[model samples]
Target chain A: MENLIVEGSHGVYFVPYVNFNAETGECELAGESYLEDTVLFYNPLLEWLDNYINKKREAIKFNIKLTYFNTSSSRCLLDILNMLKDFEDEGGEVAVNWYYDEEDIDMQEEIEDYEIDTGLHINLIPSTDLVKHQEDDDDE
Target chain B: MEANNLEKKAQDTNKFDLFKYHSLFNQNVQISYKGPFDSKVLSVLGTYIQFTIGKNPKASKKIFNIFIELAQNIAHYSAEKNLFGVEEGVGSLVIAEYPEHYAFSTGNIVKNEDVIVIIEKIELINSLDREQLREYKRVQRNLPQREKGNANIGLIQVALTSANPLDIEVTLIDDKYSFFAITVKVDK
Candidate 1:
């Protein structure tokens, strides 16, 4: 399976960055995701995870560094996180790191909700580190 | 408080100033648009709102998120379709900035029969605290498609995001139609 790389854009609708590596099973969804068609945009990512879990059978490291996501996008994120939870439950090695704005109480609550709802342990990282990493990546 | 009086007068006289102007009320209206609530329109309007209120990051974030949900609510659920060729949710939206909080208001027509369920959803949201609202939203979002009904999780999300009760007004347009309006306030 080839890697999925989507360049996130901030036009009329914010599209989140998606990088799903077929080789390493390291995926990261970054930036804001307020899409025109929430399901249409996220369905492919879901399919990618499904394939990785079923076919690849490799450990997955998922990183979500989103500054903002609307409710529609939140539903899609829940779907993705639930998939990861299923994979973890099946004795698959899965680590999910969610990076959010530190000062955003709403985002913090949302992350907590996702954890309780999906029954998945997620590492909460502040976006301060994520920001420095982005800056470094930009320099490359 | 001269501007306050003018805004009250406008609201009392049912004369909401549309567009970028202080025609008959205060300059509280930061943004106003009335047209087809399609994806293109939503995107542009969302951007405009972001730009206009970008000064206050916290308030901007709350209002923007609420605006998107409410705008999409209008886009997806509004009964009136201004455009003929496509499925469009046509409605009106107004964002007013007061001293304390920013108010996001949107309205569209709905079928009279559905109004009861809509009110029930709002009342349910209004009845809950933050924790209960979160749980309710989770339960509703996790429901099967068949059991979901039209009471969308978006409404609950709107309530949670704004951290304020939904102010709803429904007017009977006719036997089959009623205008449903919702206003949510986000503190600045």
Candidate 2:
């Protein structure tokens, strides 16, 4: 299966950088997500996940790192999380890691709320250590 | 008796002053969110608000949050539709600035049945002092999670973040739908 990649934009519609690999079963959505057309923006991502879960049924590792997102984006995020919840219910191996800025109290609370809303165990990772690791990767 | 009379006159003057002040600063920008509220439009407008109003971080943040929450509310809940061309909610959002603060206002057509619930929630928030509201939020946060799209925490967050109580006014547009208008203030 081919990987799905969308080159992110920082305009009126903020697109979150996405990297979904069918081979490695790794999906990452990062950056700010304030989309002009949220439903359209997220529909393909949902379709890809559904296809993977139904056909390939692989272990998926999902990572979310968003610094800022409007309330409209929050609804789309919930939809994505619910999809993942369903995938997990179907006996799929799923792990979600939510990276947030430690100092942003509102963001931390939002992550907690998402965990409550999704009923999926999400590891809340601080960005400091992750940034350092990413820097190391860039050096290599 | 004399003091009571003086107090009454003072109150009347205060009311007049408030009316005059609001009228003077009533210049507003109203935008309609049809299809997925264009994030590009939002960002550009948000930047303009920030630049035009002068950059005080707190004020800017309040305006941004208020705009996002109000816009999303319309995008998600507006009952009127123009067809499948755009899955957008029909609503109007207005941003007005006064010398002391900026007022964010949103109005949209909603089912008449939902008005009571919305009013009750706003009244509940208004009834609480800041500390109590904070505690209420904490309690809500601790409660077992509800289904997605069921959470009513947006208004609470708006009240808390803006440090202002939500002021809502509802008008009966027709038998089936009511126009709900909510305004919140952010100090400059």
Candidate 3:
């Protein structure tokens, strides 16, 4: 399967950067994710994961470092996590490391909620650098 | 009732008195707009508010989160659709500052029949604490795709983001329509 790479945009709506490397089994989503059409924006990435898990049947490493996302996009994130969880439940090796802003209590709680909702063990990493990441988002 | 009182009081005093208790048009008003709350308008307002609502980053984030949900709520559900044939809803939004907090409010018209259900939902949301609300959101999120109700979930997110009770006002315009306004505050 071909890899998926999408350069995120910060125009009238924020779109998160996505990169799913099929060869290496490494995937990442970063940046703000508010979008005009959240499902449309995320469906392709979900399909890519679908293809990776089904066709390759290999180890998967997912990294998420979003600084902000609307509720609709949050639902899409859940969809991605649920897909990964399903893959892992069927004996596929999967690891997800999630980075959150240290100062954002609500974001940290949001990550915790994801763990509870999807029954996935997410490695939560707190970083002060997320503030800097948001700065880069603004520059875009 | 609140809207009617505000109108009567404004006409009586010949000034811009608001809500009969608090003045939303005071010098602390940061941003105010009345128009179609489509995606483009929300994007511009969201960016501006994200950058310049208040000095506190935490508070600003809360306000921005609440604003997006409320604005989009108006965009999707407001009864007033003034964009010709499109569904771009029309509404009013305001952000004002207080020494201890920042208040964000959105006002729009709605079907008179919906007022009771809306108020009941708001009260139910207000009754829950942070933990309960989080649980509510989780269950709502995990529901099967076909049965998910996004409109209620939007308001739940708003309440969760602000961590405050929603101050809602409903005024009967006639037999068919009513003005619905809701406000939330973020502590600075």
Candidate 4:
């Protein structure tokens, strides 16, 4: 499977950056997303994950670092999480980490809600300038 | 002749007073616009909110998100048309500032029959407290997209973001259309 790379744009609408690697099974979505057509934009990312799990059966690592996203995009994010959860249920290795602005309690709560909705443990990481932060910290 | 001249002056003064309230530069409103809800207009309004809110990132973020979510509602669902054959929707939006919070309001014409559904949605949103609203939003979000009744997800998000209940007012215009206004308060 080929890798997918999309450069995000911040114009009349915000588009989040997406990078899904087929070889490493590492997918990262970052930046702000308030799209003109949310589902249309997210369908490919969903498909990529579909192919990775159904065809390759590789271990998947999904990293999300969106600063902001509208409700529609939030639904799409749930779809991604649900897909990962299903894959893990079928004995596939999956990890989901969400990085958000520390000041945004709403966003932190949003990630928590996703965990409750999908029944999948999501790692919530606060945004910081310092690189190489430890992942074993508390999961607030 | 003098009496007639005085009456004419009175009429002119009344017209001037009406114009003052409708003026975009009216001091009562921090920002106001009446036109099509196009991308260009959305960008300008977004920047204006950011600039006006200044250093309060928290308020700025809430107001901006609320504005975008509601403005897009007008753009997508308003019964009125701007470009006619084109797909753009037309409406009016205003942001009024107060000591504690900014009131963001958007109004658009909708089919008279649709007013009840709109009111019911707003009422449902207003009836819920913060936690219930979050739960409602989660359930609604999980539903498949493109469902007709589920379009209020944007409104739900606005409530979640602003942490304020929606204040909605509907004014019947004619047999076919009514002006529906939804307002949200974003605290500074």
Off by over 4 Å in 1: A129-140, B1-24, B83-86, B145-151
Better of 1 and 4 by TM-score: 4
- Candidates, ranked, DockQ: 3, 4, 1, 2
Clash-forming residue pairs, model 2: A12-B39, A12-B40, A13-B40, A36-B39, B34-B88
lDDT per model, in order? 0.83, 0.72, 0.85, 0.83
- Report the lDDT tens digits of candidate 4 across residue range A1-140: 99999877766777788889999999999887877788789899999889989999989989988877887788888899999999999999999988888889888888989999999999988877423221211221
DockQ of each: 0.42, 0.28, 0.56, 0.45
- Give lDDT tens digits, candidate 2, residues A87-108: 9998999999999877656677
TM-score of each: 0.87, 0.62, 0.88, 0.88
**Docking model 3 quality class:** medium
Chain A vs. true chain A, TM-score per model, equals 0.91, 0.89, 0.92, 0.90
Provide chain B's TM-score, model 2: 0.74
Which of the predicted structures, 1 or 3, would earn the higher lDDT when compared with the native? 3
Candidates 1 and 3, the one with greater DockQ: 3
lDDT per residue as tens, model 3, B1-188 = 69789788778989954454255467888888988987777877987887876457899888888888888778878899986676788999988898998889899999998899999989999999999999998988776543222424788898988888899999899999999999898888
Question: Can you give the lDDT of residue B28 in candidate 1?
Answer: 90
Off by over 4 Å in 2: A89-91, A128-140, B1-23, B26-43, B49-59, B72-103, B106-117, B124-164, B170-181, B185-188
- On lDDT, the leading prediction is 3
